[model samples]
Target: MPRSLAARIVQDPSDGFRHLPHLHTQAPDLHVSFDVLGGGRIRARMAGPAVPALRGTEHKADLGARPDEVHGASARLCARWKERFVDFQPVDDQGRALRDRQRPFATVADLTAAPEHELRAVVADLVRGGASLLFDTLLRGDDVQTAVFRSYLRSALSQQGLRIRFDSDLHLPWPMLCVAADPSAGKASLDTLFARFLGHRHQIEHTGDAYAWIGTPRTTQSQPVVSLNHDVRVGRTTKADAVAKVLADGTLCTVRTTYEELIRDFEQPHLDEQLMYFWCHGEFVGNAPEPPVLAIRLTDGTPFDGHTVRELRADYRHSSFRPLVLLNACYAGLAGASADRSFLSRMLIEHGAQGVLGPLIAMPQAFAAEYALEFITRYLRADANAGRITHDLARHFAAQYRNPLAFTYGLHGGMDAQLERANGGEA
Candidate 1:
């Protein structure tokens, strides 16, 4: 018997690549055209001449006699057919060859006004066929790009019966954000302070050069200590061991896993509750036919791409324990607003996480880890008899750096509220 389409559509958790065929080959009739725009105008161009003919006359004559050479020369002769021909021949679709010549504004306008249904059909076919398509557009600015991308994503995902939810409206407990990156790097500093202000009620897990608990100052009398010295590993197999070690030492756990294990663990119905802290470095490509994945380091010293935040959202709704996900990776929370869709943090809340905290700016790796640990330690272990733990945490860190940039924290949902209440205050 043949395998079901659903079975074929699902990717293997271990490898993370989809089991579908190439999108182009699968949809031979699909046609796509590019329009390079600058200052709100189109740019017309063409292909260059073929490689210089073979040196020897006899060899050139033999090559010229070949049908391919003849066809190549003929194609070059026609201005409209100068470039490489594909399913969407400019001449066939636009009635003009995209040659090395300038065209009037009307011509460009006519091409843009052409039936977009065909283009939509091509995109739909690629998605349904299970092939990932990357739509990389250089927009005017971050805000503009984000808006356009979000709109396009909504239109695309809605066709596939998926929706992006917002975190604030969901009212779930705010999740603890953890970072495990290189310390020398400043990427994780804000994250560390945020964790601390949350009352040091979280955990800091790392596999860097040293193994010691960097504790917060208990009182003005006692100094913060770093006493434990141990070897820490960063990949998947050691993730569980690291968590176990942290728990044994009576500290909160922030475990880092291989990209493959991250996906596998998310998909599994049962998850370890004690493993509360989650962090990783991965790519999040939205609206692609292939699932978005977190690129993680493997046990064999190779890198693997795991599933997207969407896949994780689905798993969270169906799983037993939905761990709060702190995606230190770039573009993780980049889902923009369009119709009813929200960002990745919102998706996590809808599925199962209490809440998610990530950065809006590109973070440096080492700094990200250090700040994350510091924040987690302070929040999980600090005195929070005062009110507004989450807000205070954010504020405290902001003050320490004495820079507004240091307080760049975006929160989604009630997880922030939960943390505040848990720390003995109201939000």
Candidate 2:
């Protein structure tokens, strides 16, 4: 099964060498094209074996929409349940029992103990509500793109891995947009969208060779105090530990912690790691004239703003090294508006990474760690490529966990790309 979608441009620095080893035997199953025109206007088109080509179906993105409006709907929906739960009173008798089961919770830890179904209900509402906004806002009134997107949803629901290639001036986080059918309200329902597809399972890859596999873990916190957000035990170390164990057992890669160390390491010739994984903090610092810079921290807790990121990528772009980066950082993959373009993500794509994956919003540490572990483990053990492995793992994780966090991660690149394994064999 095809397990991922890829987006790239003809001007990609990696150029001819971006094709993966596994793709040598076959032709691409899908192709998506994007045209960025004068005055910030952008247009997109999707065609594949599963799609019926239609005339005049090219869809244009509304770059004119207020930056806030373009990405606001989904962000608000995600927070709706979290904020509403406090004031929500269960009207039915069962709602009381549900509340009791979830009571005595002052902190996130206490919240985590709530019944899975109860939590799922809240998330489902978010998914359904958010899907409508996405369809209307991002799909931008194009019947063809909407129809093709619906087919993609159905394919994902059927457990068939997806391999889509998108070419666009502006990167759209396709996975963040939800689509589901709702018969009762005469609109899409939450149930259908919630069951649409697991997010982490899909890989957004790029068409290129991996420079090398590298993992950087920033396990310790910058501040000494334990706040509610910080107190939530995230698998920061657990994710790093798991990857380290696997790599140490024979994966060809390097793991670094400090910013200085990582910078020095990359300056050397041996730092040509293709798969770059970072377990650190990511921030979206909004400013004028520069869009929003994604601020990622080093081991020493220093910040690397978007400009710095662009510079680093330029260095790599000029060299023979190109990487596929995975950021376990918050907001690194946040679906942003045209006004607040995803600086880090775009920087990476422009620099030469075949693809990049990161959470759209802040994700639970424990859950993120577990999810990474699952994706990495499968990537190593299965014959499927990275995208397929992600799809399968996400499917299992969503089925078992039932949390929407799994869907928050966004893929920006060739989700269909593959790499060699530590065992010196392609998986």
Candidate 3:
């Protein structure tokens, strides 16, 4: 892929290896933790070399948001954010997002299409607003010098090479979280509102629960298997078809249009696949008594959740069942209030999957299809890592169409994962 627009504008020369583990010591690292309480309250804190400890009276605020109230932020129901939320159709896994945050709800009609500038404004709002949901309370004057200091300092200190992780059970779209930026700081194109998102500035991750292999990890290189949703439409210029073309042209892996076939393979102790892509409907499933778990369905509506894999898969040997799962479904990236880890992601990680990339909100099918096409194309290249691929996609969409939905997708481990092309192998 060509240099990203933001990278080109800033003249920041970056490579796929920027997020490698060895280079982390030269710069600062950040770790933020959040503990969810009985109510919608969160007990949050942060620590890093860049974060200083203050010895004074701490001013803390009782900040709590009802899960239902926060739903309005993504709803089409006439409310404060409805105007901007209308641009991209969003769905919820809860299946309970109300029509309006306020009574006598209003609805917004699409204005043909939102202009780039208007879209960027919404991007800034969503990023900064999402950040505020978590950090605004973490920021009262005493707790923070400025909201920017907490979210942007460590990243700005290291520039584009950021080694940061958000250790929280609540999988609030971490990349979409942004702090306020000075508008008059620079006149460069890279300084546009689009560049202010956390994902655009850093190599990010969540719940760094890594498993160590009990034995020597296998070093063999075999052709990977690329699996797509069984329901992908095949025609000219179709996103799923285009993504299939990517695999076909590269001879990347053994491709299959699978649904139950995947379930059957995953039930075994060892599945010989490197990358698994799902382009089906996904949502959170649960009643109030039980915590919501994210789940996906193929054409047959077979429920594929963490529990499904745990019960079906045989064992967790280092050589078995490990693959990078691209869950191109809505809300697959979201985790509930339990610190256990992501529903699907944690299960995949625990089951030896390298990493999982998915969306945090209800993403439209068209965007998900297009996103899969672009992401899969880059995934086949040896020079791009998962983190860079996702972040770069955010920049690409923002620059090309001012769409910020790409940032809604979060990286669960495997930020540094790079795949060898089936034909070319590693560079």
Candidate 4:
């Protein structure tokens, strides 16, 4: 798939000899494209495949309605999460658990664990309410919007093991958004409620327009090349060590210790890495009045944000430079507005990265480490695409260990991202 993909692009950056391995960028089974209209309104058009009723025809549906002020629905949800969990009940400096609170902490195993149930309920409410915000705010004039979205999701329920992607300008959490049925579809049972979350039910991907392109491959690679860019101070942490071990075992590992070093490396014309993993801190930095821009730190604490990448990789348009990026930092995965400056997700994607996966909030390092190990291990050794792998992980953590941190990680494009053989097939 990687080599064949290289054949499609008009420009080639490699020397006449080497090939660059491509990430999976296949089309989805169903896609919904959302565009922001003025006044928090959003317009949607379902592209490619049609709803079940309209499938198998030569018709292409452009479903649109008067959009509403969903302007910062995703932003609001993120804020709510931090306020509920972070400010009120926050993680310790090590990201262990809620800061020492007198309210009595409890794990899932404790029969009288109010905190566990409370957290679960909070997550559920956030998801469903987010769904309501997205679903309701998406098409607001009449029953038209509801009908269109519900019909789209209902048809989706029938398709097994395929991803359903959402594209938009809003920075909303696609995975956390809930799915609703029309009053007529009947009330869902408790056992079947897991399907309510778009992330759990489907291999969901939400990205900006032009989120992907054909990724190329390097024929010379014995094992994929991986780079670990982390803060200098976090070297001794379990999370950092766990990730380093994974990279060491599966691929050729290169380490970047500081923000200056990462930017300096990006300045180089060629970045041969197939996977770029950043185990650092993501911050929202800015002046007093201006909204804080998202930036990252690498022990040295210098701000490394998207602006640097956009400036450095602006010329990557024809480079065939595609690497699956994992930002295990806070606020890196929270969806953002369409304004052009300092969007970590958009900056990387617009510059030819295949996929960008990261946490939507300040994730505790404990769960983040486990999630990264599972994701990276599968990505390196299994044939599953990133989206399917994400879905499976969500289920795995929720069921096996009773952890919900998996859903906090968001995927931008690269749903079809899986290892590919030189012959253009699944590796």
Which candidate ranks first by TM-score, i.e. highest? 4
Task: Please give, for residues 1-427, the per-residue lDDT of candidate 2 as tens digits.
Answer: 9888897766866544544434333433555554556654545455666455557654223333333454566566545533543333334555443445332221222244455555556555655565665455545444554556545534543443446555544444555444453533224333344555335323343222233222221112121111011111235445556654654444455556666655565455334554577777777676566566677775577666556655555555544345557777777776555524466666665655556777776665656666666655554454565566655655565555444455666666636445554354554
lDDT of 2: 0.51
> What's the distance in Å from true for residue 173, model 1?
20
> Each candidate's TM vs. the true structure?
0.35, 0.69, 0.70, 0.78
After superposition, the stretches of candidate 2 with alpha carbons farther than 4 Å from their true spots are 1-42, 55-68, 77-117, 140-160, 183-193, 197-240, 286-289, 313-318, 339-341, 421-424
Error of 1 at 322 (Å): 4.1
What order do you get sorting by lDDT, best first? 4, 3, 2, 1
Stretches off by above 4 angstroms in model 4 are: 1-25, 37-41, 48-50, 53-68, 85-116, 143-150, 154-160, 181-194, 211-220, 235-238, 287-291, 337-342, 420-427
**Model 1, range 55-81, lDDT digits (tens) per residue?**
352111001022223223222212111
Off by over 4 Å in 3: 1-28, 35-83, 86-114, 138-161, 181-191, 208-215, 233-237, 252-259, 335-341, 421-427
- Backbone clash numbers for all candidates listed: 38, 25, 0, 16
Of candidate 4, the 10-residue stretch with the lowest lDDT total is 102-111
TM-score between model 1 and native: 0.35
lDDT of 1: 0.31
Question: Total clashes, candidate 3?
Answer: 0
Instruction: Quote the lDDT for 50 in model 3.
Output: 44
lDDT of 2 at 138: 46
